[model samples]
Target: MKKWKLGMIVAAAALSVVALAGCTAGKSSSGADDKNVTMWVHFSKEDPEGKAMVQNITAFNKENKKGYKATVQYIPRSGSGGGYEDKINAALNSNSLPDVLTLDGPNTAAYADSKIIQPLGKYITKKSDILPSIIDQGTYKGKLYAVGYSESGVGFYYNKKMFKDAGITEAELPTLDKPWTWDQFNAILKKLTEKYQGPAIDMQLSDHSEMAIYSLAPFVWSAGGNITNKAGTKAVGYFDSAATQSAFKEIQDMVKNGYTTISPKQKGFQTGKYAMLMSGSWTIQELDKQYKDISYGILPYPVSPKTKKLVSPTGSWQYAMSASTTKTAASGALIDFLSAKAQMYRTSMANTVLPARKSVSDEMMSKVTEPMRFLIKQNQESGHARPVLVKYPQVSRTFAETVTKATYYKENPDISALMKKQAQEIQQYLK
Candidate 1:
């Protein structure tokens, strides 16, 4: 094992857009009569969803009786280079924050903790309409701070054609009704590895630590281990625990025995090299385009023999109002629009991301294809939301570092000692 420093630089290219003047300050409307609201979204303007989003907002404004209008500012994704935090922080400190903004799941808790975002629980009339698990993602300290707009869950994606070639029956494939135990999952991996020349499984563990952590979470959950305490306030002892150590060892064993490949540079599942890849439904469009011959399906993460039940990690994007906004009413209205059925339809069209509402997911499932339907079902029924707390970002980063070190080192790092040290560092920042 070699000690490696994670270094990758990918710049986010800015989109070309005609600037709207009134949208500069987070103000409502232009003249004394018009109400204007600005939303800073985390998507490229060139993206199809970004185009659809503009159309949806325009339509919403036309129908709005509240005289509310919205302007969308596109923010590029800072891929592996990781400058998103600095951009967000600069925006927040300037008090020029957008009236409404979207945030990734892991960062939601940090925003909520800062009290810079208003909770939607007060203004929302349709709180009951949202899924409990989705709602839980945006809640901090029992207070609902944001509204979930889209959800993604981790699962094993298997190619039906490849399975057929390997002579594995559909019954043998992991499913909701018959999930795989760790041993069973490895057996399938072994078979796939033997049948295929390349890696049996594709586990992306390179630059984006979140991807690795997300892929591995189900195993931790299934093993009765977790990255942090249930409240997410303290780092847990699981990273170096016997259960986690065993899980990492198993993964390493798979790599050594030719059952899996650990690569930082491989293209995602869309390439169709590996028999199975740990991925989310977000990859469906790419898969549909790139691997037309392969019939793919998803299943919950395999259960550990000790846990006896499956656990999958759930992730989502949330909408929140900036505390700096002078127009709370206008921001609330915009948030409401985002949560409405109409906007949800726009979201579905733009990104294949599943809607946060249970009814929306139910309606969308019937209309979508096979694996997506299964993915949504698994997310709704069996998935577990990441624990929400103020220190989530820091904790997640440290957890990723710990996991990577443990997996690469092949020896369990001192979990208790590392956690205690990290806990102290976090407590200082938290206080």
Candidate 2:
């Protein structure tokens, strides 16, 4: 991954300390004498779903009659890790980490490697029914250290009205069973561009050239190429291979040929300007609010022309217990509660994220709207999580940067040179 500018890293590190200091003022509910279990959560307390989670925790506390109660501290939603990383790092340095906390997928491995988090192996025995992929995402160095709360994946969001106006039927929109291949996807984009006078597609990468790499991950993975190897010690070399080059060239052609537009100020997919976009299931809530009349649906990202199978990037949030916590049983119990059958069901009701448990997801599918049901099904079958590694964030950033430079540079954007540089950087870091 690309290295952050020294200044940005220093600034983020400094801000993190201040953020943690600010959070220390909040009073704990577990009482001064009673052992307290603190939770670091990323969700905004002001959001209705976040409020519901607080209410649920309260209800759980009352019903369980556990002597110890928990207190949640909200992390600000700025910087990478949504400001939670800084708080976590501060807590780690001071050895004051909360009993439990939420972790981004990539960060889980890093924290686990640092030995600041406890492995959840014992706690997970009873919850063995959780999906293997979800469980795997929280594992690092052969130990299960975190429990996933929700699972998300990237997919294509198309405007149904645009399809209809183009005389493209619902049958034409790619589905799980009938996913679109690169050639087919390109054809569809071409058709949409020809039929619609507005912006055909919005890629949302204009300023930070590296940002497009995240948007193109599905394509790379679908093509059986990856930004990095499984072990995460080196960058993948296939990025400049003929197949991968052709795949990226298609994206460039889409932009240059008017089939796609790269914009910084564009609105969501619900707007008529773009017929389709690459996004995760998290957008369902906003889409429901913004485009009630337009029929929109999601499908797994199209497969690469070189590879026939569709692949989608896994996006998830994990719950982990802090190593410093004295109340292991209490914190473990809370993790169990979150992963329990009934509470897992609440994951869907309260936060639109897919449950970590398949059973809960099955039930959630039955209750949620049609579009969301499709999203859940796609997420279950095709989602691919980011690899767990200590240097994942850095690796991800590097990969994003390399792809962006290749796509936006005026002169020859030597993909081979970029890949070699990335590999050397990762190798040095690992050593």
Candidate 3:
């Protein structure tokens, strides 16, 4: 479960577009107008994680001893009213939203901006212990709107055999402290292209929908460019900046020089056709499960040689409360119970995720293997959350479409003109 495969439609915030689904539920028989604390999530009790959450909720309701028990409604995550965005929209329209709900990190701003959810800054019990990026992902316009129990990350998954065959030594590749510079990375990819029978790198174009923007963001940021201005009001100079253009040129060089392919012989890195894969840490599980003999290494994402700055994509699901809810106290209690250090650790370990809290991540990484440690270090040091703005959907989509269109079928694209067009389109959503 890529868990949060970000294939969302880039709809303007004012347009009311929702992507992804949660679960499905009918009104429980607690009396139609029951005022018990209520919550909604994207998961169901059918799974272990869901079951565990239910147990937690039950214990919390009983332990609080306030007679303010909570009920949860599950919405089908793949359907119209149940999909993440659709369900939230439906709930908003009918004013039937639960007192507490979950949101993806990037979507927190949209909800906060639209006044759909209220700030929960005071409820955060371990602000300093949590990953800085997690807090950043939940903050918008200077307010904390959400909190996440778990987190995910992207990394460079490489084939050890391919690297060895290319005459590349492990010491020469990217390390946590000293990752490959653009020139060094480019030179390696060139050599890797010759050794790799399939594609030099599995950029995973099939993931062009979300991965295109999410995973590729580090490059732009490392070069000191961004998808939007700090205020999130526009994208004029940020997306079209010289730093971004330079990153695009390197991407162009890789393509022009035959370092990648539109159609790789094999779609998977485990198949040994690709030398490197710019993918999520989930690939570790996939590797452990299959292709036992394939030697692989996980590397930190490369930085811009020009800026020499390091960065990596960071964000995941978060918890938020309804603005209209009268049960702020009860809702806050639920958030605390669900995101407690132990709870966060349980979910992170179960889902193979990096904990959003530094302490929890430290504990879990102590029990996990390989890339988890690497991911933990990187998440602490260089994790950069996407733009947390109401205009993020627009900005993200624009960056994805603009940058992808710039490089997809053509090389040496007029990146400046394309970015300007992107900036113009983005300004429409500023209001």
Candidate 4:
């Protein structure tokens, strides 16, 4: 999921305009032949995710009846819009895109609108088997353009020992069906703070990157609010609405009341300095392999007291067909093969990512740990895809900035004004 963030090209506007002007739709450049199909990925071959991808490609070449042989070039991203994205941008300008490529979830609309990628709804064989959240993130304007192999989710990673020490029993803990509300979660935080005499949770507040919005947006949605309209064309009213304000204010109050800190210590939960940590699926791997000193469990996202609705975030890198590809049949076959149940399960298990297919998750329940199964269930039931917009990078950055700004209670006491300023900045990107 973190890698997916790098796929959010900073020069999306330029890519859109230049690609629209330069690309020859339904035309093939180099890299694809009658039998050879080429693709680009954002990870090195040595990476576990990349390794799994290679295995899938090998399996596809051996098993597919179409006799399509696919090869991948790994241009690992160095920074936001570097390496793989840099290559994609240059390729878009020069009209040299490969047959298939991997793109982040949020960039689907921009790529589709600029004719960089073609829709894949008709080509997908197992559309019904794939998670709706995965399909939701990959579709643009009612057309499926991409398919995610894995999904992502954010939740509460609590210290089991710390909870017990605070007199909070296991029975008192929340579940997927009966998740804690904002008020209920706050009460637990207060008790933990009193018992520990320090911060109760680490929200990773100082992180000013994609993580800010990736993890925090669920709070707004759970409050029955949104960052933009359904069409994703406007943000002012939606972003600065009362419901959105209430969500941030509750978090702001946490910072002010010492329930959580703006600058959390590294591995605070594992080291027993914090009772809970707000993080994503990646942390599960770290906790299991690197930080085994503590007992822990993952909890579903807390809902707003008013709405009592549960929502968690979901997005990841996905496979899409380049519009420039003349090998549409072979390319679509490769995509379906990569996103199918067997490959999805393999990559998800090998990479420790959530599977994009319901069947994959169900199969995983028999093999994966309880916490992993819980995350899979929450992702399937409550996952909310991020907004699909052409100017997603700019809009996402502004929304993240708002999260950081709102927590600075003494510096910015008025939530409405802060949201308004952030909304106005995002509006520039929308226009």
Candidate 5:
């Protein structure tokens, strides 16, 4: 759901620590016997996501006939990977890592490159049944090092009542196959702003978090631009390219034209103050349970006028076997079981997250709301995983900061210069 954060000190010490600790690392501190497997996750046991995980582990422990038992420790991350990541970093130095652990999807490359996590391609029993985007996010160096239980997709959630009030017709709404062009989308926003007499969309521009990259990167992709090259080894040309600049300029234009606000009201879309919101599946549950009075519909992301290619962002937390563990067999088994169809369905239903497996989504088609089914379809068809770089956190942070700086600027920000500077800083990490 969010990007993982790695402390600078931990990153700097990674190579030296791995070299010193070697393969026998954490054997003494893991505390798992041959028959027992220990796992770690980043949410509280009381949270819905946490409860679903506990249920999955409970089911795995009861159903598995391999004479293996599993247990979980909840580290409960606060802000962006907060306490959970801190604990993991500490464990990395002390060799106290668990047998299995959950890491954010973007961290697969970093974790695998550092030998903190192990590849599991041979261990996954239902590899083909998993969604391609989910698999794409977890694979690094041509090896599968992680498996996400739930996937994510960002789209435009529009207020149905507000759209109707703005004189928009049902036929004017865009679909996945024929998404509105950027100009058409801008025209719609203008109409909505005219009717509401205020900002028409909530882009959450004030939040300079991972949400920035996760939600906005698709615009860059749709415009035939990238934050880094295909190999993810450099960003100088890609991040500062003309296509990338145009995409950011489009976002900045929304703020400049008063179509969206940097400081939006809390729950503005749910409260009907904004005509639309750009968010992910998590907002589905919140809108249903807390703002049931509001009528909403999900729309495919508006494509670039030039390319008209539909692309939506995708990534979330995933399960990986810890390299420190000696019990590879049991750890792999636990990861596979938790990511299996049944467990993925249960966790996704409870958490209102997008399913990472095709079978799970098919089973949920009749059970989920129309908007959720729409999101699932969007994810299946157009989802694009973020860059899988060893230094992904640094790149993501710089990208997010660029969005924030551009959005809140008083005048037209130098989009090219802004991206150039950030890309140069990110290049240092790429090397």
Candidate 6:
């Protein structure tokens, strides 16, 4: 969401928010038994993803394994406008956190650091089956605190018709074996801008929360810089590094050269307002469904000009148990059941997300649609989770706000100075 969106959520959530509603009896109701494991899942019950999960839980409950009764408490899409964070914080403070819950990819660290969730590694033994990036997304300070059943990935999507019109051949486009260097990519953006009267690429710059962090961090990664250092301790040299500066400079250049606007366009690529886009795999489904007339192609993220490395973003929603929940056995059982190979395939297939487990992903490749298979393959090979740090929220918000500030004005930011300021701000939140 955009900062305004988040701001509205936080401000409104300050009054009343529905973090969890309906059958939230997981917090040890009067007659609740040990078999009652409840989940506070964020998906709207009206959506297909939510409906499918509810159905899965219903089926699981039908089994009555050990007489367990699994239930779901629908968490609103955006609670009181603060989104998930505010709702969750309220729930935690009220001592009403659900026994099992789902968290976005980058939030594991925040919740773990706050002691809202517990380490889950001991509950599952088949961690090897899960993608390393998926595991990394859920880990905090070396301990696994969460695990996702499915994954999400991002790629550079292009308008094939625009490419053809610009005299760009398939060979010129970056391939997995040969991603475009930063220079090559900038040159192409320039060409696209000159050839197309509209934007060259859709940065989706308007939304500044998860979208900002998920899409932009990879560029920093490709440049061999990070939101935080390797030890996950500091952002000083990393966020303010020369490589990181160079990366953002290119982004600023794209804006300065009229290749992309500082704000997201309304269906820019789909409507031919933009020639390219950096988007999630789910976009393929949206395009196919909402804009079947448009011809588009997907490619790996551009590599760093200096490092020649590709780091594609990966992480979606994952389930984590509440640290204070007493029903470990039942809650763990529900989590394991959710992440089971068959269940992963089922839910991921229904949701169009990549399965986290290799076995489930392979099965999906063989059985799911071509686009789904393609995304699964990319996720398996090139996926990289966001920096799992306790202060990820601050880091993400700072970097996003910095990027926006850099592009908001006609003049670009002083890279080192702005980055240092951002790094310093993030440093203050390290403890």
Question: On lDDT, who's better, 2 or 4?
Answer: 4
| Runs in model 2 lying further than 4 Å from the true structure | 1-36, 63-68, 79-83, 125-128, 197-199, 207-215, 236-247, 413-431
Candidate 1 collision pairs: 28-36, 29-35, 29-36
The segments of candidate 4 whose C-alpha lies over 4 angstroms from its true place after superposition are 1-32, 79-81
Question: TM-score for all predictions?
Answer: 0.83, 0.83, 0.87, 0.92, 0.91, 0.88
- For 78-147, candidate 2 gives per-residue lDDT tens digits of 7544477776676665567778888877778778877778887786545666776677788887788888
- Give the Å error, residue 105, model 5: 1.1
Go through the candidates in order and give each one's C-alpha lDDT: 0.70, 0.70, 0.76, 0.89, 0.89, 0.81
In the predicted model 2, the residue pairs found to clash are 1-394, 1-395, 1-398, 2-397, 2-398, 314-384
Which sequence of candidate numbers ranks them by TM-score, best first?
4, 5, 6, 3, 2, 1
What digit string (tens of lDDT, one per residue) describes model 3 on residues 1-431?
34344333233332342322222332322344434778888876675557667777777777765566788876546633247668777767666677898887778887897898999988778688888888888888788889978877888888888788889997788787888888888788888876654357877654446567788888889999877788777677777789877776666666667776545556467777788888787778788878777787788888898788889888888888889887787788788778888778777877787788888876877699877788878877899988887766666777667656655646436766766777788777775
Candidate 1 residues lying further than 4 Å off, grouped into runs, are: 1-34, 80-87, 236-249, 268-272, 409-431
Which parts of model 5 are misplaced by more than 4 Å? 1-32, 408-413
Please, what are the lDDT tens digits per residue for candidate 5 over residues 1-431?
12334565567699778877664344443553687988889999998998998899889899988978998999989865589998898788777888899999989999999999988888899699998888889999888999999998878999999999899998999999899999999999999999999999999787878889999999999999999998888899998899998899899889989999989999899998899999888898899999999999999999999999999989989999988888888888899899999999999999888999999999998999999999999999999999899988888889888887788657436887887887798888895
**For residues 1-431, could you state the per-residue lDDT of candidate 1 as single tens digits?**
12232221111112212233323333332235337887877777788768777777888788878888888888876765345455567666545676788887777777877777867777665788777777888887787888877777767787777878988898787778778888888888888878876677777655446666666766766787665566654443544466665565565566666666556236545556777777777777777887677677776677887776777778777788877677778778888877877687678657887777777886796688887888778887777777675766665676566556544534544544544554455444342
lDDT of 4 by residue, 1-431 (tens): 76566566646766897788764452345543666889999999999998998899999999999799998999998866688888898888768898999999988988998999999888888689999999989988899999998998888999998899899999989999999999999999999999999999999998999888889999999999889889887888999999999999988999999999999998888788899999998888888898888899999899999999999999999999999888888889999999899999999999988999999988888888878888999999999999988888888888888888888899999998998888778888874
| lDDT, model 6 | 0.81
Which scores greater on TM-score, model 2 or model 6? 6
Give me the overall lDDT of model 5: 0.89
The candidate that achieves the highest TM-score relative to the unseen native structure: 4
| Per-model C-alpha RMSD | 10.0, 8.7, 10.0, 9.2, 8.8, 8.5
CA shift of 25, model 5, Å? 12
